[model samples]
Target: MLKDVFVVAATSFVALPALAQTCAFTMECYETEACQDTSFALTAELDDSKLVTDFGDLTVVGVKRDAPLITVFATGEGAEYLLSRNGDTARFTAHSNDGPTAITYLGTCEGEF
Candidate 1:
């Protein structure tokens, strides 16, 4: 009986739910500056608290994630941009800052995570 109990406990421990799960998303950003008129697209893959971006309109150089937020760093010529997003949803939103200029992106991301 003790052996059976130990086996059951071991199985139960293995069946425990994960504390955290990774999220992979593909997002397209259309309309800039938090609902303005300039179309763009940017996608990112998030794992725990890290993100890697696939460049579309902006060349992603580096990425960092803090909880539900993600920031992707990029640059081109004399322009530098800081891009960021929050959460994982189809209705995706992102923000970018280049010196005195700031831009926002809105679109759909491919994920149910």
Candidate 2:
């Protein structure tokens, strides 16, 4: 009985880290110009509190657990972005620092890490 209990405890401990999973996403947005479109990729490391992408590294600041939304900020660029996940699809929106230059991203989940 003691051996079984220990095994269960060990399994739970190992699985605990997997509960905080990382997600990979591919995002695309259209530029201000009518014919321009930009594509990018990003990864959300929930356990590490980071959003990694080609643009720059963003620090995850807030999360809405009930709705599965993440708010991240980049200090160097003074940018704030919201990543909202709905099942297999996700929407990302970046707010402009100055004015009128915000971008919207539509993407799908690549997988979890």
Evaluate residue 21 in candidate 1 and report its C-alpha lDDT on the 0 to 100 scale.
23
- lDDT by residue (tens digit), candidate 2, 9-90: 8888674543233344444554564433456677777677777778887887767755444343433275678877666677
Cα error, candidate 2, residue 6 (Å): 3.3
Report the lDDT tens digits of candidate 1 across residue range 8-106. 988886754323222333434434423444444444433332223344344557766686765556664445655445654323334334344443444
TM-score of each: 0.38, 0.65
Q: Give per-candidate clash totals.
A: 1, 0
Best model per lDDT: 2
lDDT of 1: 0.46
> Cα deviation in Å at residue 109, candidate 1?
3.4
Evaluate all candidate structures by whole-model CA lDDT and list the values in order. Answer: 0.46, 0.63
